[model samples]
Target: MEALDTPVLDNHLHLDPRYGRGIDAVDDFRRLGGTHLLVVNKPSWHLDVEASEGGDFRAVFEETITTVEEASEALPGRAWPVLGVHPGLVSRLVDERDFSPAEARDLMQAGLDVAAEYVRAGDALALKSGRPHYDVPDAVWEASNDVMRHAFSLGAELDCAVQLHTEASDDLTAVAAWAEDAGMPRKKVVKHYAGGRLAGPTPSVMSEKDRLETAVERGEPFLMETDFVDDADRPGAVLGPKTVPRRVRWMLDEGWEDAVETAHVETPKDVYGIDTRATLSR
Candidate 1:
């Protein structure tokens, strides 16, 4: 595929230090024509049983901010941070780490509070939080949902966008309803790692064209993402960071430039309040 002439941002990706390949991954993505990325803090980097019990995430939050800063200095204009506690981690803390419901809630809330501070300080572009896997225990699922609701509330209060990492088969209508209850505008909700199966009023960063077409029919805004995990063991577990840009190049080759531009350019700027041209020129 030909290189894209227009800038493209991968809306969700993990480039934390624990990954070990963070910098290399960012470089690879940039070399492949990706212009910008929203670097999310991995759950393991923050949530722990002890921290959960105490409702403290000061250390983890500081590390996450440092990671974002390092990535920005390395790639400049191409890296931004998305902060929040992951629902999956909350479930893990309860189920595997033996954290109580109250402890888990405290941990989740603390993480959201810190995330709010980062967004308010203009250090983070959005909040990343959502429900865990579908097969988790009902109690654990509920706890995760509670944390997610809290995240939505915080995002609304801060006027920041939220990137949701939910189950593949989950109904987004329910999620959107939760966002509405939290006073978060549907437009500020983004379904991360979305494909062709789900549909809802909120925008999504998706990979499949069929899903993209379905979303467009509903007149909701959307973007595209590779969800690159940057894991050597899972090499391209979701898709390479370059996948979105390569797809854009192919779409351009097919004379679908307008549609491609809408997803890769227009929708991202509208939703995230980021200007790719402005970001890259900095």
Candidate 2:
């Protein structure tokens, strides 16, 4: 992981401003000469995880969005934001928990309203890019489409990209359908953790890499990202941010660039689907 501090894109980053305002983390990244730090929103369960700290679930999304806006003001152009939605659509997850759609809509609307402030400034819409995980229902798949369609409409209106998360599952297909349904601009979608699969050895699933290549060949705006993290004391650390790029870099160097635009981008603009003109400027 020595190369980690080398200023990678650090896609799928969760910054709990509630944790050090990420000043130390940014310093650590910059110390390694890192270029960008895309601060993706974190799941409600992820806040203060190592310390059992979490903000109000209802406010987590809005708070994070506002935080990204502030980071943009602070960094001017370095803190790229990512609007990735993981944990299988917050509404679907909480619905099973007895939260009504009306309640969820309130949270979503509030979050989106706050999100719009930054999004209008040009943030990429980061989606989980996954199928159903952890017993997520099929309805969640439709739920994902609903989220993507709505997000795609907003992203397109804002001239941003819809960063969808997908694996071997048909998640990408769902997104494509959503885009078509919304008549959103289609490009190579950003594929996070290109070959990284957290599901653990499911031979039946399609690898993230293959799907990305497909997206690229199809003339989609499929970008590859290194969503690596350093979790020392965990064997999975080997697979986190360190290794994701090694393989990605190899293929990228070996003619993959023609297939799609690959970059180590981190900033509110890049994360939420903006053109990221500055972040990708090599």
Candidate 3:
């Protein structure tokens, strides 16, 4: 793989325990010129069973933080955590865990509280919370939005960034409006796994050049991501972990270096305050 002259940062990925790919994944990214990555903990398929059985969600949060810490120690400043209660988990709680609406709200609030604490302590970078896997029931969708609003409010209070995982075609205008209503800046919101059609003022992360060109043409700040699921069963589920570096190298080769620089370096710093230069040097 050809490395870019400048380093890149992947704003969203899953390096969870169940996935089984650990430091080796990190090393592969680094070798491809990936300077930093944000490890987002999306509640796995099995979390519903555990949470329903009275398993503490805090342990999951702690485990994610620990994994990120270990990765950072192994590859200094290269791994960071973005903790939150995935919105899909809310429906799972209701259907699988037999949680009432009130109970689900309570658990979601508690999870956000823990995530906020870590952000305040500088142990995490951002909160990754939003609707996942479209086609949810209307009630579940509304409830998830309510949870997301609460998360945005907490993020505002804590001055932490938020990464939203929603349908690629969903209107971000509403999302940006919600963020503004929650007293959070639109710039602090990132639309995870984004594509060409943008809906609002918030930034987005995408991988393909054509879509990236569309985002750049709109003059909106954006980042890049692989959204790597790390599932052996779903090889390159979204894109491989090293996809960003290779795409960035392609962009640089195609005379989009300035755009790539802004997306990979400046936009991440603006959104998450990650100083890649300083971080990599350390």
Candidate 4:
């Protein structure tokens, strides 16, 4: 396939050197014409950080920043970091660690504060937060929403985007409301692992033919992502790192050059305030 002129940015991705391909996975994407990506921090357990306090999350955030730095060195100015507590940590704290719902919520909110510090220090570009995608008790659900809103507050204060991992739903109106309530723009609340039917919040749709086509046809600005878990145990679980660039090539082949520019260049810039063209030029 011919290399696309537009930049290919995977809005959500992971790299785990201890358990997965790590830089090699990133190299795969780069070799396939992926010029930019956001190396989002995985769950705390992925890095073996058993955090009972906010500062313990530092280990996870630092590891992610290191990965982004390595990726940028390989593909200059092409990789940025998004740091925050994974919403699942709430359940992990409550069930696995024996914390109460309120305690778990407080710890997670504090963890997000630590993530916000990274953004403040210019070490990260965005914060990741969302409620669980599975069934949970109402108390856990409420606590998770509180945690998500705390992230929004941090994003508002830091002037950065918040990438969310939430349940796939046709109506995300309440999520939008949460962002608005926290003084963050709804567009800055990126719905990671999203589909085309989301009614509110910016969608970071995975790289699938039907989903990409659907998002494009909807005439709403959205971002593209691979959601590569980068776990050796789950190789290519969600999608591969090469997916976005390959999808870009397909979009160009199918005469969706404008969509390529929109997803890769325009939407990312609008949401995260990062310019892929500028990154490429660097």
Candidate 5:
């Protein structure tokens, strides 16, 4: 198949050479016309690192930045890092590590602080944090929201985006409220794995045909992502690395060229404040 004139961007993806295809996965995306990636850091435990303090997360963030750099080498400035403490880690801290809920929340907030430092230092483009996507105790739930609030505040201070990984919900008014309280703009907060237009933060719609069509028909600003975990054990768990480009190809084939530019170029640029054209050219 011929590549489209416009570039495709995958807003959320993970690349781990130790457990997955790593650079080869990135090459897969590239080969399929995906020119840009927002490479999110996996949970700390995924890297076999258990963090007690903020500094302990440095290794996790650094490894993610390294992956971004490596992906960029193959695709230039098209790849960027989004680092943060996964909300699920709170459960691990409390359950396995035997830390109290408050302590776990504080540690996750500190880790987000570290992620902000990376964004401040120009190593990453955004910060990521969200509440658990599953059932949990009330205390754990509250602590997770607290951690997410800290991330919103960090995003406010750094003037960068914050990608959320939360339960599937069409309504995000609570998230919007927190972002407002933290002085972060609603548009700057992205809802990863979104289905369609949300009431709160901008949706980063996953690459599913129905959702993509819905997002386009709505004519509201939204980003597109594959959420590719890149795990060999669960190959194409969420979606393959090539999904975004392939979907973009569908958009173009279906005569949704304007939607392509809006989703892959304009929306991401507005949220992350990056020059997509220049990055794609590089």
Candidate 6:
């Protein structure tokens, strides 16, 4: 309906070593006139799988949380981390050494239990997803309900959002499916691109046209996963940084100015749990 400016939120960004070089490392995240940058509230959670298998789960969990708290305090406003048990965390629980499907199922169920209490109980939102490429077991799909409901409740109160990767580009589908079981709020639901989509295909690659059309038909708001890292070359391409802006413009060109709300780039209100927002207005 209305033409908006170039401001947009890069919904999915990772603070890996490549991006987190120094204090001013995040300066580039704001290059496109973004508003806020949401990051992992707890990065240790993402790495727990490796630690659990090689080191100690209990120690890893404790160390991860502590590090997250400390980092959140340091960053203050640049990083907004979504907390929850990742599927990668569960993959560690199985400890098949091979990371088999059946083992993934058992660990997936455990993660739901952990998520229900730790994450659902005001810890953080869990960002778990299963990929057919990974050949993951059905257990993960079955356990999503128990985990999502808890995560959503926490997110609702904290004024935060949780994203689920259930094999779709539209936020509504992922939100609806999660709501059916977890009762998550649609208002907080944001659409995102798949992390591995760049390696395999574009969001519009296979079910691309359909998902884009569905988002248009339902007036669904879309967000970008612009930090996707490609592995095709000696050094993969950053498909999102270049592709996301183009897609957003394309959607606007196709007449979705109002239907698809662009996520404004923003700074984290707080780093870990610090009061970075105190400086900014509500």
In terms of lDDT, model 6 sits at 0.40
233 Cα displacement, candidate 6 (Å): 9.4
Could you tell me the lDDT of residue 136 within candidate 2?
A: 50
Candidate 3's residue-wise lDDT over 112-149, tens digit each? 77788888898888887877566867777777887788
Q: Please, what is the whole-model Cα lDDT of each candidate in the order they appear?
A: 0.72, 0.44, 0.76, 0.89, 0.90, 0.40
Q: In candidate 2, what are the lDDT values of residues 17-95, reduced to their tens digit?
A: 5643344444444444344556666654455321111223325556566665664443323665555345344445456
Q: Model 1: per-residue lDDT, tens digit, 122-180?
A: 87889888887567767777778888888889888988889988888535888888888
* Candidate 4: worst-modelled 10 consecutive residues by lDDT: 1-10
Candidate order, lDDT descending:
5, 4, 3, 1, 2, 6
Deviation in angstroms for 238 in model 5? 1.0
**Model 4 lDDT at residue 177:** 90
Name the regions of candidate 5 deviating beyond 4 angstroms. Answer: none
In model 3, which residue pairs have backbone atoms overlapping below 3 Å? none
For each candidate in turn, the TM-score is 0.87, 0.59, 0.90, 0.98, 0.97, 0.53
Comparing 5 and 6 on TM-score, the stronger one:
5
Give stretches of model 2 more than 4 Å off: 1-8, 17-23, 31-33, 48-77, 84-96, 100-110, 122-131, 196-222, 228-282
Please report, as a residue range, the 10-residue window in candidate 5 with the lowest summed lDDT: 273-282
Candidate 6, residue 280: how far the Cα is off, in Å: 7.8
Residue pairs clashing, model 5 = none
Total clashes, candidate 6?
18
- Model 4 residue 157 CA deviation (Å) reads 0.8
Clash number for each model:
0, 32, 0, 0, 0, 18
